[model samples]
Each structure stands twice: as C-alpha cells, then as structure tokens.
Target chain A: MTQQKRKFGFETRMLHAGHIPDPVTGARAVPIYQTTSYVFEDTDKAAQLFELKQYGNIYTRINNPTNAVFEERIASLENGTGAVATASGMAAQFAVFMTLLEPGDEIVSSSHLYGGTKTQFTHTFKKLGVKAHFVDPTDMQAWERAITPKTRALYGETIGNPRGSVLDIEPLAALAHAHNVPLIVDSTFATPYLCRPLDWGADIVVHSATKFIGGHGSSIAGVLIDSGRFDFSSFPTIAAPDPAYHDLKFYETFGHYGFLMKARTVTVRDTGAALSPFNAFLLIQGLETLSVRMERHVQNAQAIAAFLAQHPKVAWVAYAGLPDNPYHALAQKYTPKGPGAVFTFGIKSDNARQAGKTFIESLHLFSHLANVGDARSLVIHPASTTHQQLSDAELEEAGIDAGMIRLSIGLETTEDLLWDLDQALQLT
Target chain B: MGSGPSLAVDVSMNTILSEADRAKYMDPGKIRAALSSTKTIAIVGLSPKPERPSYFVGTYLQYEGYRIIPVNPRATEILGEKAYPDLLSIPHPVDMVNVFRQPEECVEIAQHAVQIGAKTLWLQLRVVNFEAARIAEEAGLTVIMDRCVKIEHGRYSGSLHWVGMNTEIISARRGQRYF
Candidate 1:
C-alpha cells in the first residue's frame, strides 16, 4: 500500500551484498573457499542436506559459500529474489532452459545475437528437440507472429551483439507475460549498472559475468537471476512434480524460489557446469569495480562511435548511442547512460573485406579477438572469423556486412583510442 | 489494519520496505523490542527434521536460553521441549508466536495468536502474509514479517557480517548484546 526508496546504491551492493568480513582472521576481503565439500555436523545433518530438505552446502558442484556471495550480489544488483552461478554464460542459459523447457517446448528469440548463442539455439537445441524461433528483435510484430502455443519463453539481448540494436525490453516483456511465459534477457552487454532488465518486467536475467562483470578479463563465468515475480504455479516444468527429486513439486513447494532451486539442485547438479569458487572469487573482485569500469567503458564508446560515424574511410556505423541510429530512441529509454561499448562499423573501400582485415591488423591499441566487454579494446571482423562460414546473403540477413568491424571499446584514454582508430582508418 | 486476506508481496531486492512497513515490521527498534522483552517463542510448523530451517532456528533459540514451544501435529516433543498441535492448546504464557508455515496458512495462525494473547507474531523469511500481519497488528500484538529470527539475532549481535553478508547497518560501533 505504501512505497519507499531502497537503501544501498548499485556500487554499495556490488562491494558488500554477498559477503562480510571473515570473522576468524578479521580479514576484510573475501577468502577463496577452495574446498570441494563441507563437513556435516552429524549423520542427521548430512542426511537432511542430501535429501534437499534443508539449506546447506552438500557439494561444490551445486553451491559454495564463495560462489553464494557472487550469486547473491548479482541477484541484489539485478533486483531479483535469487541467482544461480554457472561455468559460463552459455551454461547459465542452458541451466535455465533445462529447468524450464520440456522435449516439445519452444522459444521465440531475437535473431540478432552473439554468434555462439545463435549456434547453440539453432544447432545444439535442435538436437535436444527444443525449437527456437528467431525473429527481428526490434520488430514487435515479428516477435508476436513467431510465438506459438508451445512457446515457453521470449528471449532477447539487452543490446544486440555487433548489430548495435537495443532491445525493446518493456514491450517484449509485456508480450511474454501476456502469453503466460517469461522473458529471459541476456544482458551481458548492458550490465546491471547500465540496465536492470528485471525492473523493466523481465522475469529472468542472465549474464556472462566473464565479460563486464569480470572487468579484468580474468575469469569466465555466468549467472542467472530470477525476479521471483512471475507466478509459475501454472508453468508445467516448475509446478509439475519433478521425477528426478523424488516427485518434488518445486513451485508448489518452494514458491517464489522454485525455479532457482530446481536450477541449482537439479540442473547444475546434473549438468556439471558449476562455477568454481576460485573463478567466483575473481568475478567478485571484478564486481567491486563494475560501476567504475562501466562508466568509462560507456564514455569511450560514445566518443569512438561518434568518431567512426563521420570518418571518410568508414562506410557506416551502427551504434544506438548515435542520434541517427534507428534504435537510438529505444537506447535512450532503456540504457540512457549509453548504448553499451560494443558496436560495429564498416570501412569505406571497394574491397571492404580486405580493408577491414588491414584495419584490424593496423590497430595498436585494439587487439583482434573474438571476445567483447574486456577492459582492453578488442576488434573483430565477424564476417572473416565468427561468421566466416556464412554466405554473403546469410551475413546480410544477420545484419552483418562483409566489411562490418565490431569494436569493443575499452577504458583506455579517449585520445589514444581515437589516435589508434585514426591511424587504422588511414591504413584502410 | 484489519482481519482479512492480506496477500504477501514477492517484492524484489531493489524495492525496500515502505517507511511505514519498516517502522511497523522491519525497523531495528521494533525487532529489538520484540526480541529483548521476549523469553519464549511458539514455533508454528516447526519441522522435526534436523535440516529444516525452523528446526535449526528453534534449536539455536533454545540454546540461547529462550523456551521454544514447537507446534507440530505429529511431534510429541522437539529439542527437549513439549510440542503442541496448535497455539490454543498451549496452556503456558506465550511471549511470541514465530511461524514457518505457508503464507496462505497464516490468517488462521494469526487468529490463534490473537486468541492466545501472544505479545508478538513473527514470520520467517518468504513467509509473509499481510492479512495475518494486519490481524496481529489490529489485536495489539507486535508483528514482524518476512524476517528470519536467527538472522536478526546474528545481525544485531554483530556476527552476520562475519561471513561477508551485508548487515545493511554501517557503524564504527559494534553490535551490543541485548539478551
């Protein structure tokens, strides 16, 4: 009936939510909990844990105290009830799907996505008998037309990979909810500092903590955060009795925590894709400086996208932060701080593909790599590598041209980065 | 505040409690008042299983010198204390009624708490029922919802943060013992 502002800002939660000082040693920082299993107080306690009748760590494959802090902090930042940490973003995504989807279940997802995810959905999921329908992320009608009775969820990226199209979160979330399904947003690019998708009505949020969350590029990790607002009492996979756990009905039993509980105890336990406590610890360190890193990441990206937009050697730049870009308004609405640091541009030359290769090789600051969201700048020509096997028509359909050079702008000095870009452009 | 069906909200972590709700339900002052003045807690739905949170909490509270009354239909006694099937069956003075039951089951439990004239009605984490909270409030019983008794005690005693948990209380001052 009444409302009040939440205490603890993003930065505060990032540094402190999941952990407190070590009581024994008086250590201020989180210590790496490297052990595989915990000691049970007695035989009864061990039985209780094995039965899943209580909450305590039975094995590292499911959860660890060190990873618990990482999961909790991520959940707090994303405004979710809880989270499950996984080995990678791909693993996190898989854990969620495995928990929610059945053999015949389907999902309607945005066509523009990280190439690895696309392959996972199209090829890998195909083997699992789960169908994924990809539609233009920006077109509301296209998303609607793709949903079927078997569709269990609507999926999208907060920021489209390489294409620079920001997802229409609010509307897409509404569409998913109206269909009695959840919207899962891959917000790897627009980290919670930039956009909290759960605040926009998404039921679940997944992240590649390997990227921005682990700003130093030191660890590969991922997390799945659940808003706990969706009523899954009617959703079959959640509400129905799970045969694996002695006919335990998750939603009816655990209520708001049903999905995450199932995701952890069953999915991660059986899947064997748990995030090691060591990696979780590194990501925790990365989280401590997330807001600081993201601010600079966004600032440099806005400047770099602008610089390349007007360059004579650049044919086109697709950065939502640019005013003339199609998704600029949506970007302002969803990610007003900036449209994330990763974006794409094309070199203006007759043999643009060759020029793109030369441009990548000429850059001193930007490393040519397949990853994005690193603290260091990265350049990738998807057509020549990630999307190399795709025909020109396939590339065009995916909104990537042969000359498309995706840049993940880092926190380097803006002038130095601009100089690097300038020199590389001249070579192109 | 009146007796009726009060739906427990599944509020996100970012949406903190309302000022009125905080003062009435989550305020440190109110929680302290409930904890310091109370010596006995009637645990409704207190599972006998060792791993169940309610059982562990009851065990901890009993160890802390509070008389824990376990209310489970099937258990004759728990943690060396007598068990009652319902609140009304307890013939002794009950200082607080702590609940680990479902949200929908709370309205009836609140009525029993009011009937038994308990001083406080406390719900465990994720066990919030606003109607029950309102009923207990209307009956002049102190109501604390969606908070764990063990955690609150640990927090106030300055031990919750020992394991890297944010107490949400920043202080150069240490937590003072109340009991």
Candidate 2:
C-alpha cells in the first residue's frame, strides 16, 4: 500500500492517497487511537524510539497513529516531507516559532496577517526576545530589505486574512532563498485546491484546520507542513546541538525530516500542543469533501464579490476574483482558479459604526461570530470586531477602514448568498 | 517545579498589582493591595442585555459582595439598579470605573472616571487606550488595560475549572485514603 502510485488528483488523494486500510485490522476507515502511550516490542525498542533510531510512537502527545494518517494525508496534499498536527492554529504557529527561533532572532513577516498571528508575532514573541519585522508581502523589495543577518524566515499568507490580498509567492520565495531564509505561507484562506504554495516555491505551509480543513467548524485544530526543501545544514544554529535536549542535533539525526523532528520533539513535546484524536478524526472526515466544498466556496465568494463590486452602497471591494481589484494580477499569477472564500468590502457611509452594525444585524443566514471558514457563511465588521484592537493607523496599514466588512463565503448556493448579501447591503 | 520559589514570589507580587502595572513595573505586591481594596465599581456603557460581558461581570462582582453602579446613557436601569448617564451622575463614591466603550471613546471616559474620584480605571479585555491609561495613572488611579475583570477575579480566587489530573485524593471517610 505504501508503494502505491503517487499521481492522483486532489479529490482522489483526499480520499485514499497517503493512507491504505489499517495494517493490523485492515479497517477501511482510520482508527482513533485514543490511548496516550504506545506499546514497544521490548525495553531496547523503547530506547530506540526515544533515541530517534526508530519511528514508532512512544507517546500520544508527540505522535499518534490516528494523527499520523491525517498528517500523512495533509503532507501528501501540500507536497511536504512531513506534517505536524497541533492543538489549534495558534499552537501550530507557536510550534513553528519554538522550533525555528532562538532569543533575539527575527522574523520578516507581512504586516497584513490574521489578528491572532499578528498579536502572537508582535506581542507574544516580544516577551521571548524574538522581534518581528513587518513588511509588505506584495512588495518583493520590502521583503528583501527586511532580511537581516538574524532573520530566520519570511512569513505571509497565500491569501491574507480579512483583507484577501493574494501574495506573490514565487519571487518572495526566491528572495527568502537568497537571504538563506525559508518562506512560510499560511494557506488557510486558499486551501490546497485553490493554491498549493509548495508548488510555487514555499518551503513551509501552515493551516488552521479549524477553518476549511474541518469544513463543518466542529473541531479546532492546525497543521504545519514542511516541504523539506530548506537545508538546515546551511544554518549552524538550527543544525547544531542544543541545551534544550541533551545535545542531540536535529539535522544529524533526521535529514529531510529535521525541522519536523525538532518541531515534534521540542515544541509539541514540551508545550503539550498535540491535536486531539477526535479532532483529527473530524478533520479526516472534512478532507473527504474538501475539493468539492472548496469549489462551491469559490463560486459563492466570486458571486458575492461581484455583487458587492457593483452595489451603490459598497465603496470598495477587495476580492481577488474581481478584475479591478489590486490583487487580481497576483491572484492570476498564483491562484488563477479563484481566491478562496474570504474577502472584504467597504460601505460608503460616514456613520460606519451604525452601518457596520446594521449590516451584521440584518444578515439572516450569515453567523456573526469571531471564527471564519465554516460550511455556513460567516461575516464580521473588522473595524468594530476582529481588527478593533489595532489602532486607526494600524487598521489603515491592514487595509481595513471603519466601514470594512469581512465575509467568509461558504458552501451555500451562489444565488442564496447573493440574495442575503444584497438585502444586507440594502439595509446598510 | 524547579522554579517554584521564584514563581511563588512572582505570583505574590502579581496578587497586589494590576496586570498592566506588573507588565510595566514587575511589581505584584501592589496589585494584590489594589484588588483587595477595590469594593465599589462603576461600569460605563453597561448594557441591560444579559448576554454582554459587562452585564455578566457586573452581576458576578455584585454577587461577590462588591457594589456595582451601571452607567449607560441609553438605559434607564440595569440589573434592577438605577443606571446613571455617566460616572459623574452617580450619587455614591466609586472605587473603580470600568470602561466598556470603544478604544476611541476611552479618553473621555477616563477623564470622567477621574472627575468622579474613582481610585482605578478598568478597561475591559481588548479595549486599549495608552493616553487614558497614562492620564488615569498620573491622577493617582490604578489603570488596567486589555484585561477582563471577571477572568482575573476567577483566576485570583482559584475558581478556574481544572480538568485532566488530580494530585490529591478526596475522601468522605476520615483519613481513609492511601497513595
């Protein structure tokens, strides 16, 4: 089964690519290994597993069989060496940072990022003595200029959160490579169907599996996919033995899986950020229909973006699918199929607070919660809700005005989504 | 566990000072004193709606033996108390004025809180005003920014629900359990 053909379309792969029937039980469905500790053959086998000489699970916190299947499936989907399943998207980002950075190191990242990611990079990492240099992800030169000697990675989203700006990954990846840094792309918005950043030159891909991957929004989880293209041996700090774990060098032990090994052993092991087996099971179920759901998501989003663009009340629309959008050209270059479900629009009203409130309150089908990327359409006024913590200047920098409304188009029919949106717009 | 001694000192200090002050000065003793002494609170923009955080927090504090004055211009009353239009309109003294308005409206609220002789200005979680916090602090009022009072109360009082593991055993019989 492991020797099966690798070439298959995403939908086929999503169902049966990386996984076969369970070896022991021959179960077609992935089994949930709810146990915490895995049994070893003997004492020597346990030592071997602990010493990284073998590759079987010792503990569920580090790895589990159920999660391994999910990891393999995601890794296969993203074209990565290995993947790590985490407790949440935030935990995934935390695991990545903990594995890659030391105190006083820096990350060159796009200024426009998810609110939680921005907070973690700007506020939380500051406590750890790691600095984040915010740069324009669209501007290749800004990325080049931001890379200093201590810059560890270049980070951006394939489609930026709320703003829906599509990043130009190929050139940005080249810039990162020139600086001896890896490019980490958050592909939560543009799931594997719309765009696979690895094919476009990204070294690492991250996702909030709670969003699209778990399509129903029933589970909160995240994944980190290592492309295995970045050479750890090129950077002495990452390759060298450390005080954190008994002087065992990551690169020396695991070649292509070096970063992933470090991420598993150090970050997930110590921080206890392992994904729940139940959540992994839910995510696997979601992946079965990912390709189909994503297509509908794109169809609905395109229709909504178009509807808003022509509306008299909408001052600006920032969906990449729209031809007049600033990100349309980059979207064509990177994600030509369609920008994933999320996009933002602005109301042309002075009483933005009232307009924003009315728009949200008037929506019948769209839920107005803090989360996005659900099977049902989601909407929020960024100026009053998601990006409310950011200052006016910071909001402007994030391309959010007081009247801006972020919509996460889901699997609903295009006509229904447009009708709901049109009535809401009329109310606004 | 190895850093238990240092962590104890840190927690003790944190008990006395506000989290914002601790982040600024690393003094926890001051936080504990401020918390213990604050008995009366005025919640600005306190909604009558039970679902809102302000309403629930105010109710929780009231249940915990603290006097709560709801201040909202739009509401005539909330939680059976006659709501004042602002802090200045309150008949009694307020120890802490909790501002639940947007960040842009915080400065005016902070000034009113000071004018009403409030001892501290508390901004709900995610509402930040550097200028307001600075002004309140300068006026000899304790200022806490981007923190939920109810969460802090629960955390400090050890009321947080813990799942997973129990180190100690609970027995109905006297000294019956053995490890």
Candidate 3:
C-alpha cells in the first residue's frame, strides 16, 4: 500500500522537535543546558566543529543543545530549512543585514514598523553606510520603484505595528524574487500560527520571541528562520569565498544552508549576541502553549476592536477585522485569523495629546507599557512616548497619528476588558 | 558471496528503471517496518572522519541499538565497531545496506547488496540513483532512496529537525513526546 511521509502537526512539533529523550539522564523535558563551553569527543571532533565540517556544540556563542531545540522548533513551525536565535529581535535583523549587506548596500522597507525598527533602519544603518528606503506598505508601485541594483533585500512586518496594516506578501515576494532579492518579513505580530510568510514565498522570517512566542513577558529573544528556497549562488556575500575561514565558499559547500550558517558562525560569533540558554528555556516553555494563547489573544482583539469602533470617545480604529478597515481584504488574504492582537485607535478631543494620556492613565485592568504580546493587556500612546521625536510629517509617513493609542489585546475576559476600555474611553 | 553477478538474483536493470510503482517503495508503513526489523546495517563508503555524514549516521544507529557495519577499506574500525572494505566483505548477515556514496557508485553497491541477500537498500539523503533502485527492487530488495537513515531514524524516534533539515512530513499519529 502507498503511504505519505509522516509529519507531526504544529502542536506536536512544539512539544517534540529537536528534543530527544535524554538517554544519559532520562530527562523528559528540554533541559536547561546553561554552559559556556562543551566537552569535545576528541581532538579530531573539536577540529571538525571549528572547521564547520560537523554539527555539534563547541561554544554557547555558536550553538548550545537547549538553543538548538528552540531553533529547530521555530524552524519547524515556520516551515523553514533552519533557524538561528539571537539576543533580541533587533539582533536578528542586525545579524541578517551584517551577513547580506556590504557598505553602500540598500534595503527597501515598509514605513509602518515598530518604533525601535524604524530607529535601527534609519539611524544605526546610516552609520554603516547602508541605506533603507521606506515606502507605504500598501503601495506595490512604491516598493517596485524603490528597488535599485544595489538593493539587497525587501522588508516589511507581516502585521504592521501601531497601525494594523497587512502586508501584501504574495506580490511583495514576487517583486523581490523578480529583482533577485529576498523578502525579509518581521512576523512578530502575526506568529507562525496566524500566518507563515515563508509559505507565501518569503525567503527569511524574523520574530521577536519575547512577545507571543514567550507568551509571558519573561524572556527577550529573537530568531531568524530561513526557507532554504532562495538561490544565493549569484549573491555576493553568500556565494563569495570568505578570507576569515580559509577562503571557504558557503553557498558552494552548504547549498541551501549557506546564509544561515554564515549568520551563526560569522555574524553571531563576531558580534557576541548569543541568546542566554536560560532565556531559551523560558521561550521553549512559552512555545508549548503558543497556539492556545494566540487563539484567545486574537479572539479578545476582535471583540475589543468592535467595542472601540462604536464608542463615542473613539474617532477611528485601525483594526483590519473591522469592515471599514482599508486593509480588510489583505488581512483576509494574509492573516485571515485577524490582523493580530496589537492595533490602534484615535481619541476624539481638541487637546488630543492630553486626552491620550488620560485614556492610558485611567485604565485599571490594562498595564500601560511600551511592550506587546503579553498575557496581561497593554496600552501605549506612541505619539507621546515612542514617536515623540518624529515630526508631524514623519509620523504621518510612518502611519502613526499623534492622538493614536495602541492596544495590544491580551488574554483577558471580554466583558472585563470592554469595561476597562469603556471607563478609559470616558476619561478620554 | 563473491563480488561477481549471482545466478540466484539474475534480473534486467532496464525493466524496473522507470519505477512507476515508486510510491510502494516509499510507503511509510514499509519504511517503518523495514527500519524496525533490520538488525544490522552495512553503511557503504563509511568514513573515518568524525564530521562526515556516514560516521555520524553509523554512531546514531549504534546509539539507537542497531549494529552498524562500516564499509571503508581505509579504516580498520569506526565508532569502535569493525569496518569492512565493502558490503561483500561483511562475513555476517546484513539486514540493510545503507548507501552514502555518490549515485554513480550505488549501482555497484546495490549489486553487492543483492549478492549478499540484504533485505533493504537505503540511499542516504541526496544520493538518488534510479538504476540502482531498479536493480535492488527487481532483485526483491526494498529500496529507500535519497533519504538519510539517521534522519529517518530520528524522525521515527522523534528527535530530528536540526542542522537545516527540511522536515515536511506530518502525521495524525503523535510521536513519543515524553519518554
């Protein structure tokens, strides 16, 4: 009888991938292997690992057993060939850029981005002579026109931050591939459960595992997952021989795994942004219940979006689930599970800045914070806090309104959350 | 058995070359059964290098409680087990012959496997040879091509997905999550 290859579902992989029952200790759960160095099997084995001729842990900076489990599990969920974990989400982006880009290399990115990302892309990248061209994520023509010969990558968040605009992944991927560039997606808002961008043709996926992947605000970690489908043979960085490692040609040697291996050994190793093993353990625990947590998070978000839309104090809601939302069709196409739990709304008042402050301070249940993807509900007024430095024109370019209050709907009782929002809206 | 063609397993290589019934050969049930039943595996082109794919696969199988015969003429022993130069050199019975050599070398290895009366012939990941497969299958040997024995064992045992392996197989049957 004919049979198909057996792959365990997402939930199963969460619990099992990269984890073997520990034969020596009989450890059932993924053990916290918090060590800076590992004992080599022999001199030959040690040499082999250092030479990149073998896969084994020589140092925590390069690979660890605990981190290996997390990396593999994330790769499995993202449907990628492999993944590498780093210190934070920014580190993941930095590692990718450091691997792919040379001096004067360019990136075309979405303007609708997390505050920190905007700062990194615009400011830090400037110091390195790399340029980032930000465009309206919805404008495919804008993205197309921005790409020049020097452009190394096309980038965007899957469900954009603050304003919940959905990226057109299919067309964006097609556009990037047409120009011999890879589309790098920050899928922090829309986790693998909501939308896997790689399945939609993206080459690399980045995530802040600190948020939904860790569910609780317990860990700060970042990961980059590679689809292994992109051809890097013609690309300068991956295909070229490296002087640092005895002129080893990565793409010629490892084929699909060239970019990721270099990112780990060369970038992560040189930069020293390796994730703490203890933090990786926390992320692993968080990942086990990801699908369950995400379900409730989005469910609460949809109800809260609906609640705020009709409220007298609220002037506008940017949730893609709303019928009048401009990104509704694209949300259906990409993140059909709703455009994530984080979204924004504007308060109707003449003194909008003061009113936004009042709305946040009046909240009893929601914790006013600068973070998202926690079990507890979170609220942030970006204009007064995150985007305070940006000019009116700059804020408009980033899709942020000065009066906008961002709500990352969490796993709270629907009625209780609505009551909190109602009281908060009254104050606004 | 000698390295020459066997009278008992005389067959046409061209008749089974296309492999129209390839699915039957790759059937998950047969693979699981073959893996479970095979006691001894002869790894062709087994390397002495600790980092090589053949070495690690042999080590992993040994850990998984399967006796592995490393077929390398250069190495006297590997992973603390005796290493034979070729499949025919293995005096004891080998239930499966796992090929790690190039596709061009597999046809000869398959012929040797047939002569030795091995039950299954497993080609390592990226080692695809339809002609070798045809020869093995026509001689009543189960053919598993272009797959890593270590990865298949790990997949079955619930411990792979690292080192950039593209894990596409999903099943309704849950694996051993906790041991």
Top candidate by lDDT? 1
Model 2 has fnat of 0.00
lDDT of 1 at B17: 55
Give DockQ per model, in order. 0.15, 0.01, 0.13
lDDT of all predictions:
0.82, 0.76, 0.82
- What tens digits encode model 3's per-residue C-alpha lDDT throughout A137-250? 989999999999999999999999878889999999999999999999999999999999999999999999999999899888999999888989999999888887767777
Interface RMSD, all candidates in order, equals: 9.0, 24.8, 10.9
Chain A: TM-score in each model: 0.97, 0.95, 0.97
TM-score for each prediction? 0.86, 0.68, 0.81
lDDT accuracy of residue A317 in candidate 3 = 93
lDDT string for model 1 (B1-179, tens) is: 11011112222232235655655677665666688789999999998765455766787677556899999999999888889999999999999999989999999999999999899999887787889999999999989887878767755554332222334442222213223
TM-score-wise, the better of 2 and 3 is: 3
What fraction of the correct interface contacts does each predicted structure contain?
Answer: 0.02, 0.00, 0.12
Q: How many steric clashes between backbone atoms does each model show? A: 5, 10, 5
TM-score attained by chain A of model 3:
0.97
**CA shift of A348, model 2, Å:** 2.2
DockQ winner:
1
Error of 1 at A54 (Å): 3.0
